[model samples]
Target: MSRLAVSVCLAALVLAAGPAFAQTATPQTPNIGGFPDSPAIPAPTNATYPGVIRYEVDATDLDRHIVSVRQVIPVTGSRITLLYPKYIYGNHADTGPIQLIAGLTVMANGQSVDWRRDAVDPYAFHIDIPAGATELEVSFQWLTQSDNSNWRVVMTQRMLNLQWEKALLYPAGYVSTGITFAPSIRLPEGWQYGVSLETTSFENGLATFAPTDLYTLADSPMFAGLHYRRVEIDPEGDDVYINMVADEAANLAATDEQIGYYENLITQADRLFGSRHFDRYDFLLGLTNQMGGIGLEHHRSSENTHAPTFFTSWAASAGSRALLPHEYVHSWNGKFMRPADELTPNYNVPTENSLLWVYEGQTEYWGDVLSARTGLHTKAQALVLLADRAAFYQNQPGRRWRNLQDVNNHNLLGYRVPGQWTSWMRGTGDYYDEAALIWLDVDTLIREQSGDRRSLDDFARTFFSPEGTDGDWSPRGYTFDDVVAALNTVEPYDWSTFLRTRLDADGPDATAPLDGIERGGYRLTYVEEPNADEKAVSRNWGSDFRWSLGFSLAGPNNRIAAIQWDGPIYRAGIGAGWDLIAVGDRVASAEVLREAVTAAKGGSDPIRLILRNGQRIRTVELAYHDGLRYLRLERIEGTRDRIGDILTARRR
Candidate 1:
């Protein structure tokens, strides 16, 4: 084998037999490959690497829902420390996906070999090689989904979204970027593939990608299916492509107007971040409810998995359209100009998410803005999304105990928290929503300080737009000081203190956030009837985000997931996980609860609630008389509505 891909282990199915060939040799104390303490396996050098970790991914087992990966590694050592990827780049809940890797085995000289796992690192393996072996190969089956878990590689009869790290192993010593890789895939016959990768060849059912470093290779994922279509969204040689793979060809058929909106999306994004970091960009979309459902950002592309009707049922998926723009914006913000610590050399390094408030938060801010600016979302639709997100943070009781910084760092445990009493006890993704509010304040402040001469657009162009695009996918890191410096360059002020005060707060002070909303030319108020965005979100969760009543329910059953701290429900001694037994004479479904709230809208009538907390049942009278108080971003009379201007502003 060449000495590039895997510094692999080799064995001849030969054994140094002693009394070890006994029956007990395998069962209880199975043979594990290792090397002598002296003259340890020679450290693989940078110069000797063959420049590509070649992978031949076979998806023929799609019907069986398994993907077989065969890897060839160039090695010189008698042993290689190989590990499945761990600690996903931006996920705090990293372990949830790593376990999906199954049936991993290493081989040498076409013979099965024994490999030992490092006791300390669950993902690391120490493989043994027979003397004189120059290369190693491994074949493994990665199960698409676990028995009953949603966390798995998405592989269906129609398409597949390959998260490379989960399916391949790499040598441990070198930085992932320093090592090179060339990947090729053999799809089930007639299936076409779309990826941001530079393709070297494409022939019947097989595609080869240009050689890339380990980091870039892993970052470049592919979406392939029997039914696929690529729509050019930009006229500049179609630098932007909407690569869609759906369960059926009908889903691939999108209206011209719908497709036109994406073209504007590309235009607005180009206007926001002055320079393009990628040579080519793809919005790799999977319109399949069969599997994958989140948008992950990459340098040249975004993995956008949404409901099957992402195009056809656009209105119903109102708020979700933001996912695409959000991940796309990350190519400039989170992927290009990242926080220094987050720009790790390899995939295994734990991410320091303390700045996610900026990484994800700012992206969330622009995601909403750009989505609206591109006409994917109406201004009202954007406001609904912002208000919903804002109300979530304002009502989050955990924010009182944990500041935004701590909330940002909560991903250290991979976002795994007990469900009981989660509302007040735990913080979920506040950085995305809450940070959006904070950054909105920053944008408004920029306009205010600059006498409306500049806005956050100036900030983005200043920080992200380089003189030229390096055409490299690897991230260029930044620091907190770098962020403050950039803001200062736009308009001089105590940005350090300004951002620190907002992010470091540990109290439920609505003054700053409310003021920020007002600055956006709207006041945060409530109205009757949940908007389409709210109702759409409610229908999915089976409950309403009744910021007025202060609780989110588990749905048609009206069981509470959480109650806002210091809110009326909390004051009434209500807690999470309790069943809303009844509202006066009616059994408490979300409808009854809303009706009860509506009935008490005009007067100081007390709504009597019968709640069941485990074995105890109690009656509580909540004197909340604000009519169906759904949060809204209503116009502040005669105030400046710069939101529209902010959405369209660009450097001329």
Candidate 2:
């Protein structure tokens, strides 16, 4: 439905239900838009009154970027507190998916109900029920996002992803798990959908799902499209399914060899962990040029999206091939074993997320490792990735002021800050990439300390799969002390100091990379031409030599991204926001910058740069010279081939 049509529907409801004056007016300003204080009530209530919710989604308006949602919530009291959940799981902020919802109204007993927003808990809306009302029907319009411009996407005539939490409301004061839901969706006439939710029946373009709890209901998202293909990636019938939907039929055709890599992935993961958490799993993928890309993890499935040509142009998309593998590993690391502070019973309550270094960072470490083990990317590609990450952080000027721990704490806001002068102007979170390097050090330290009898793989199976639970895929929360205690079980060390020192280090300290790389029997070096990994990354997004030069070159005119704090360029007083007019006395183009660096040949002679920063034109010379260098992994050849041991795939 078009925006006009949505408005028409909303206006019709207003006219039919009651006059505009009937709405219960909100008298006060909202304070921070969520429950301000911790709840005085205890969790789960010990008494399980099964709360139920149902949604009828109309996707006929997908072309107009609209989803008509009619929701019904059963209430058991004269006064009910209805909450549009904030602080949703997965996203570590109290501001959840509330922004995506529009055109909302609650009605009961054929009368327009009056609702008031709670001043303290802004996400909570207080609605008064009629004397004999059994249920309240809430209707709204959801705009499918096309971009961040209006925060909407009309993916394609073919594909759509449904995030249920953004559409429904529930009774307040109860755990999300304590409530039950029966979700029914109506898609486009010929469109098919994939979800972990079991099917009850499908008729007249409507598909109703088997009843489940709120936690499980929200955990299972749906991917639907006109073009669909389902492949059983594992012979073990209930193990895994790869459901791929695309914009076109040709984009959906994947070769057997290409699919075999993922099959091998399932086998390798099972052997490494020695257990399964969920009864079944799904990899829900959406391939479309019409929609913005996505990668969100759930306990039983992952919502993955990429370019329409993610498979056809494998070499070009090789950089993102590990996206599937990364989210898959989360089923073990994040979904199974979360940080204790982050494991809240409901989304409305604020969650403490200081331990993302272990939760997301260690998961990042295993993600890179598993990508190599599963043949999603070659072992050489893995080395290049780590080197790229280390080199990337080494050039990040923000590390001087902030530490890795702070990055985790401020991730929600830090992620969107642009890279115009990233190294200097802002301190972005480095938990994922930088934390991968940190966890790699932890792995190497374990290997070196234990004389190869144990590795991080043991840490994985031990920490992720706790004994006695016997494959139950429930949230097993842990604290920092639990992490340190687990590390002690692997190999005793002063882990507290070891981690704190690394986290507190200021700016471009190369010790962790140098020590970790050497310990793994390899060293970081550079080459003239870009490697396969570098070429792929640079092709997608521009590349630079920030590791050595302290600033990245981007844009069509080769503009400065940021100056590394006291880096080769920063020392020369050339900074970010400066546009390069010429390099080597030639007009600066994409290739001109590279030719200038390559011509210098590590010579002391300064490479001249003509920079224009808002009408101030100046000629500057970069004093230090290192020819165009790309990061590569080189074997130390003598000590021990621990790098090889780490990359080897596990066998049954």
Candidate 3:
């Protein structure tokens, strides 16, 4: 029925029944319904945009940390909309910093054209084209972050990282791949830069890149610095370059042995995946303490940052060495073979992350495996790292309510916020580590079911690197059913039930899935001292008392860095961010706290701690005493060492 006819009939029926129904109840306060939702911004379509967008950025203003931008967008309609990039791909969130764009102006045909932001979608700007106007001139300034307190400090005194999405706007109503962009940039004179885009021309400090689709342009970022060096790590196969940039020249000193480890990384990855995706890969490494750390993955390249002494002080930077391998594996897992829901056509569309357990989880597993295979960490260090991860999930209390599958949505819910109640609320990116353990379970299960003939390596080759479709970096989306089918292809079994039990189970009985550790012929054990990996990475980060006193203290003030969810410290009513004033009678120090913990062990005495929370000072007594516990993995006797076997170099 038509809307008017249906409404008339419904109103008549309501009046007919009102007299009878009203006699039984008293009149209630009237409630007003909400207005209809504002009209949706234009949905993206496959139609191509009319003309290429011209985008240029002047990033030489280091002192002010500003990126001046000019974009010329061709138009075909009288009224058009432009959208700032949101729902960024790598970040998997609506994290576009639109507030940073300032002083935006649009002009057409030598006259200013008025523009208004959409009332519903603030990321969109609507403007009317003047009569006979062929294009619109848009200008804005992107205020780059100056401090590392919350956001990345992209522009430092000696270098800058230019992400295109932060500096340009795109036309709505078309897919990102259907729009083209000719991007160019101007850097300070004498600064060298590295990017994935093919440079067409360079004059003075300006460089113009070849025209590319908006998708690729947004994915490619530039790293310019006072000191730059590009070295080819994979010369035997496809060219893979590591573009190293640093605040000072001496920080670029990468020894030959250290570089060889990276070369072995490529060789090991080739053996695992059995195919290459990108034609050429670029590893953009920024060795700096000036810029905030990043480990974002891209289709053809990855953006990464580490300490300035990452190479010069090799052993000290062991914790960060896995970053490169992790991002490198994403080219095959996240970028090429992607989850169907996460493969959106444009940046504005929301992504469903149900399959992130496989997308990011397996990548996390392989990153660490490859790191060990390439000698980035010794086998002992690798085992220690594994024990640390296993122990973390064992102590995680949030799993009682939040399952592994639900943790996948954490990128959207919390982004990067590390809540004070970590073990209960769950920290950001728990899927990365917890899912890695689940994959380990899957790997060990496959080995056991197939009688050692097949493992996840076979599944990776069958699912991600399918034959006759290699050397192609184009995305291929897959569903959850596809994952099960591929696993069945490797070894026919009830894969669905296995994955669901680990992914969906909850309540108090839902401990972390440790079948993988036992099946891999290893057991998680505790020791009085931490292993090599923990000791190496704890240089600046303070003491670890997680296994003993249930909290950790850091910084010179002895403030609690983290507290276990249901541990002794939590039961004693102590929360994170409280500064320790003294332990018993002695003034608080890391050593003094450890001595107290050790002395209280095997005795009936309680540990006394004086703490300051804000302006209030109180003495709290901890009724538990466990002395300095640390995690370690011990090999089970007379069983196959599948984890050790997996860590063995496949190429070697």
Candidate 4:
């Protein structure tokens, strides 16, 4: 079966059979202004001359998540035009076919002019006006969801006004090449400001920044609200801006520490690249009251979200800081150079780009390594974390079903489902996990292959060198073939098979590129041991409880749904969805009995579940593993000179 089909089926089954689970509930139909249909809009034929641009946005309806915008573009030559991005970045989807542009009135020289929606791509909207018109104004209203606060404009209502996060307004002529932004924000009192851009505050709550190039403009994100702290670093060249916007008051000390961490990360990246790609970079922290965290990279800035501080302790905070290194490195991998396929079609339509294992996976590996090497994390701690990633891939069941390349290419559709499944299995044999291991393996291999002469640093320098052809990776992006060819220049070995097995095939024998490590006279084995910190954290939670309510649910058929953590069935070693036969001492109705489990709690209740494994019905007792569930890492010194040696030798 195709991997996509299998993943969908498995997800459905798990969702139906598993215990109660937590997930981001899809919001009700947002007040997304009005639904805009692309097909209904006519396409543009002729090119119109560009014009001077000025924009004004009034976003008072924070509760509705809507805004009114007025834009004025000056016609220079033949045509005057305006366009709305058909697709919002980071969303990886169309803006819900929603039209924020309601009552889009267009006027030229103070007279209403006939205009039509010319061309529409998920990336942008095109509008045409009379040629050589001195100026034009376009006004519209945009509607969105308040909870949606990653990329694009978002607002939160508190007290009497709406707060803004990730808002940017640009003149229509500029190219969106992920640049630093300079915008003018006008708001009423009781509002604060945060941006990655250089800004000057004026009277009447107006903020302005000098116009920067298109690339620089894309790199800056703006946040306005009452909940933020500005930390200035080194006033030598403009002020290094660190804007932290959280839902609650932040601990100044912690915020300072985070700012320092970012400073160090930027320095290390700059040192490695040997060039400051951007005049200024902004790091905007959007603290949310959510469970998940994400970091999105732009040319000069990154937008990040963090969990609630109360839920995250110092150790957790330190660990979360690892995201800085990861996103900062993107200033190279993703910002300066990116895969063409991803940059072109983007997520509007599915394009086959399988090199995310290199872009994202390798970046992930290096992000952590650099963090440790630069003292952001202890070497031992980093090593343990790497080992944990290895374990996760090795334990995941989905790894048996899909290869890294397949996962990368289909990440938009299958990432979460298979990802969760892989996590559940505690497997570290997948792409991110395996790529990390292989990087360590290859780093070791480079050293051994060159008799301690060369390292991954050498390879990276060559691969990412400014003069290198691969360095021109943007718009269309590079491919595995491109990366392989680059690596081959450093090491003469044929790496085609290595890429195919780990990245392409999902079979059981898909081992990591460990042969090189092994060839470097090193042996590697993964072992699990008790982690004191994890145990301590879990101990405070309470007794580990696992419970299972019997069900023979299929995703489309009678499959599993969700498995609650620390539930009775989970303790009995029952997974989310296995075909259930008998419950306790009788044939229990899956639906009716599940309701009973929810209604009842701990009372030394023993519920026997008979489930079908493959074809045979097997009975297992569910017992929760008390304490916080954490994966532990134990590595034995192999014959190899660390993992890096093995990879080095293989390259040679």
User: Over the stretch 1-652, how does candidate 1's per-residue lDDT look in tens digits?
Assistant: 2221112322212233445564345433222433332123223344435445678888778778888898888877667887677776656545535565677777777688887766445667778787776678877877777222656448888888887777888887777767877788888888887898888898887888888787787777888898899989985566899899998888887899999888888888878877788889988899887865767898888888877777787667776778888998999888888988787756676678778888998998998888888888877677777777766665566756667778777767545444555556555557887788888898988898888998888899778876666465457888889999999999999999988987887765522354577787887776677666666643443356357677777755678666677778888877766888898999878778777888897798798889887888899998898766667778878878877667663434
Give me the runs in candidate 2 sitting further than 4 Å from their true place.
1-51, 150-154, 412-416, 419-421, 424-429, 507-514, 532-542, 568-578, 602-605, 611-621
lDDT of 2 by residue, 452-512 (tens): 9998888888888888654699888988888888889989999888888877776545233
CA error at residue 431 for candidate 1, angstroms: 1.0
How does residue 278 of candidate 3 score in lDDT? 79
Q: Which ten residues in a row have the lowest lDDT in candidate 1?
A: 3-12
**Candidate with more favorable, higher lDDT: 1 or 3:** 3
Question: Against the true structure, whose lDDT is highest?
Answer: 3
Those runs of model 3 whose alpha carbons end farther than 4 Å from true positions after fitting are 1-40, 537-542
lDDT to native, each model: 0.75, 0.76, 0.86, 0.50
Backbone clashes under 3 angstroms, per model:
9, 7, 0, 89
Cα RMSD to the true fold for all candidates: 7.5, 8.1, 5.2, 12.2
lDDT of 2: 0.76
Error of 2 at 131 (Å): 2.0
Q: Per-residue CA lDDT of candidate 4, range 1-652, in tens? A: 3334545565566556534442533323332232333223323322332433464556556667666767665555544334444333433323333344456677787778765443333333444456667766766665645443432345665211211212223324434442222346565456666655566555566666665543344445565655666666533354346666666665323545645655666555544555444556666666655313457666566666666572235565545556767776776676566665555421223334456666666777668766765556654455445544543444443555566666564445533333223333322234455666667666665666667776666666655546544324243356667777876777755667656655665556654444533444433352222355433333321121112232124432333334443344545666644766665666645444353344343534444556776776778654322222334443345554454322121211
